[model samples]
Target: MYRSEFYVFDQDKPVPVIIRNYTQDDFDELIQIQSECFPPPFSSELWWNKEQLSNHVMRFPEGAICIEVDGILAGSLTGLCVDFDPNHMEHTWEEITDHGYIKNHNPSGDTLYIVDISVRPRFRKFGLGKLIMQAMYHVVIQKKLVRLLGGGRMPGYHKVADTLTPQQYLNKVIKGDLKDPVITFLLRCGRVQIGIVENYLEDEESCNYAALMEWKNPFNRT
Candidate 1:
């Protein structure tokens, strides 16, 4: 259980938040938060089952982290190490996260596959997402991993799903011609859209397609 304290602005006033590793005790809270943060189809069917949940802590103990602000379980993130050639493969969340058990996770792998992150609804506007992302970066450097990769639900897509292709919409958002709360924020955090992943997730807002992204570690530069 790694622990640290940081602050993020809440309505322009800084509020203190805690960052640390996930614990079995927090599992129920995680499940509750997932239900609140995501919809039924995805949240219910796709969450880590009992065995997978246990394996998360046992396998990649160092990478699963949680966020707390004033003793509230405000957010959390869990990752797994994956060995893959960036040039030749693309994987769905299940394939890379190893169906949540992370059964194939290689502790010495080159990439950190971020499988899940959830922020409580009330805490969403306080910049917690970026804070958690920085924590993930810290994990990459701490583990000496090469880079991080994942797919994110494009919340902005539902508004334009009928009018534009996923790629076109993402390009516009990337170019600043369009604004996407989720995708835009990640872009600011130094991740870029690698491509569109079909059936990447079952979220309603993104229409089941996620924006594939990657962030290289600054520490990896040599």
Candidate 2:
């Protein structure tokens, strides 16, 4: 479904942001934006092959929501519906996203699993990331889903990797003792820290660890 979410600005020009379903034409720009958003080791360009993206588009057509600002690709958030165990150990991106088409995609499942969210380097601080989350939240509610799930890489984790454990570092962010721009932003936006997922990505920033996080839909109950 197409949704005209909001607008941003560039040099006094209003850039309309239209949140809508993923389309075939969005592939190339998406790959480009992804490449620019991340650096080596964790850069999606290294892992997300074109074939994988083709699979994603085919499997969850509506799951891959994209943001276009001023008629240009700016950001995106892709996800899947899954029936998972609360006690199940956190999984890697490769595990949750089995080559872009998750195996445990239960259409009737209660969880909305966010696979990835990215914003181009140029659009970094425009609050587009939060808008992506809002789009996912909208999807979860529209689908009657109860819980939202995802893993967050702590770019700030590398600075304290030698000093604090992943969870310990997460706690500092949670307690507001230390600020992790990404994790803390999500926290402030209502996402709760679930736990730590080891080997979540190849990035050394988190010591290969990611924080398992969730944002429950207040209007929907499990």
Best by TM-score: 2
- Can you give the TM-score per candidate against the true fold? 0.89, 0.89
Candidate 2 C-alpha lDDT tens digits along 21-49: 77787888888877787666564546345
Model 2 CA deviation exceeding 4 Å by range = 10-13, 40-47
Q: Report how far residue 210 has shifted in candidate 1, in Å.
A: 2.1
In model 1, where do residues sit more than 4 Å from their true spots?
12-14, 39-43
TM-score of 1: 0.89
Per-model lDDT: 0.82, 0.79
Clashing pairs in 2: none
lDDT: worst 10-residue window of model 1:
40-49
In model 2, where is the ten-residue run with the lowest total lDDT? 40-49
Question: Over the stretch 60-147, how does candidate 1's per-residue lDDT look in tens digits?
Answer: 8777888998789998888888875766555677777766778888977899988888898888887787788888888888778888
